[model samples]
Target: MQTFVTEAVDWPDTAPALRERVRALVAEHGERDQVRRANSWTKPDPQFSRKLGKAGLLGMTWPKEYGGHERSQLERYVAIEELLAAGAPVGAHWIADRQSGPLLLRLGNEELKRRWVPAIARGEAFACIGLSEPGSGSDLASVRTAARRDGDGWVLDGQKVWTTGAHVSHFMIALVRTEAGSERQKGLSQLVVPMDTPGVTVKPIVDLTGAHEFNEVFFDQVRLPGSALLGTEGEGWKQATAELSLERSGPERYLSSMVLFLELVRHASVHRNPELDMLVGRLAAEAWTLRLMSASVAAKLARGEDPALEATMVKDLGNSYEQAIPQLVQAAVDFGSPDNEVLRAVCFYLLQVSPSFSLRGGTREIVKGIIARGLGLR
Candidate 1:
């Protein structure tokens, strides 16, 4: 792994300026009604995602040459925090805007950077990550999808399960094996597979909550030009590890549970009990700590460093925190007071949805394994 040092880059002098700018955009264009009614895990509106692109909020942290606004990652962090806190329906462009664009910017060829970044920043094109496979959940290197060099391009064949937004996405940046049956983490390659291609098939997977948020994608003899490869052909493991650090250590980690948290607060503020007060205080403190840790990782990303270990730490802790929110809320509601219908409804929705919070991005067990390995304990 290459080491990139993170010296303190000057935190933007007027950080509030960027925050207010994004907030103003959110006020004008944020999908407030839909977001409040439906969590972003459900399908998102494409037009709203395009509006974010036009506002220059999608790829705010990349270089200007590639259609990014060249804003600091911390500024982008502020934008994301506000979006998620408000429960904005950023799901349509979330995977692309957050991780794929940045991954392409960092590891993609110049042509890919020139081609995809502008479209992504403009929100005209959308993408999703294809890291999870049928049998391999968080062990990305265990993917069985194979890409064989054919003529001047690659022919791909395999199935990817639990792929988020594959049904709606225009492209899927997939991790497939380029070499046959290599050891634990070798010979895997990342390829950009267009969703509309001939051999690509996407079948939606309905979750227990009755939400069609994920898909089982099949690629059979799917051929792509050599340009489909993101980086080198046999470097998928390193590339994915580096890219996932960016994916796992963001505001989304803490924000998924925010809707339920806010509803709980709304209920608690009026039906005041000492236990509810203490619970809110404790949750507030945890939220603050998660924010600082996420910010630290963002600062590292801004400096082009892959804080892989730190990112694992953040995700592991954040998942634990997120998973606990619903249980904690239920405990609070059960002990003291009469359950408000709205609060009970929100809690029920969140409880049903909480399992995926740990599964998505990376599973808790996977994150802990990474942390252990990083600490030389593996």
Candidate 2:
């Protein structure tokens, strides 16, 4: 069996300062409602996002020419860690800053880069990924979305489902079949489709919580210039997998239920019980360990290493840890008591949404399969 390796992360010297900066910004303008703060990364606050952009907190690791701060990767990591820990409303620019902007910087043509990267850095533009379809679920290889080449551009036609922030996004980086009769993952390409295109439409998908976070987007003969192609044609699967590595290992993966955890801590402090104390200790230890593992993966990425397997492991473990917190808290606390109202509210909210912890980024089954393949157990 291949063992999962753990290493000490040498955090950047600027981390403390960055953390302080992020904390102060979040304190001043972050979401105040406790329930809303539970999964704050999915909460859209465009004004708050623009504030982050103005603070130079958005696009921290890209080049200056593209309106990025050109900071170290770990420095960006520190900022995001602070934001997620504090339950800041960062959803508006989160996708763009996290993976879409990075993907563009890595492989986008000059026109695409110059057009989108700067707006992204300015928080004037936001992006959503078009990876899931109605029947495709996590099987991205089964995507039926297609784009056909025209005289000097392409014509897009298809629908994307479960697209987070699609209604608020300026564009979508979609994986579509570019070659006729392409099979599975072959002949796929990533296209930059502006959300405001003439033939594009977005319909909201309200969850049980009555939140409009996901959307169904349709492209009906949407026309795009040749420059809309993000990277090399027929290489989208490779490019997309690389992007998933970025998505799966971030602080957001584990910090979704942090507000509930904090509420539990608050309740325990006043209502003091051995069971609650033990639970707090266990959850804290797991949080610390996951943080270490996540930072280690970030460190490896900083060193120019591909830690896809390790990142996948982090996502899987972190999802489980996050999804368990609410259930554990519910079991340990007396939610019927009036004094526990705050804790009960946060816990119930998380319980309703925590199931999605393993579904987003990738499903638990898919993540485990990837880990199994990496360990040669499949």
Q: Among these predicted structures, which one has the highest lDDT?
A: 2
lDDT of 1 by residue, 101-174 (tens): 98898788887788788998988778878888877876566788899999899999999988888888989999
* Residues 1-378, model 2: lDDT tens digits: 445677878899988888889999999999899998988889889999999999999999999999999999999999998999998999999999999999999999999899899999988899999999987888889988999999999999999999999999999999999998989999999999989999999999999988899999999999999999989999988898888988889989889998889999999999998999999999999999999989989988988988999999999999999999999998899877899888899899999999999999999999999988898885
Worst 10 residues of 1 by lDDT: 1-10
Each prediction's TM-score versus the true structure: 0.91, 0.99
lDDT per model vs. reference = 0.80, 0.92
Candidate 2 off by > 4 Å: none
- Candidate 2 — which pairs collide? none
Candidate 2 backbone clash number: 0
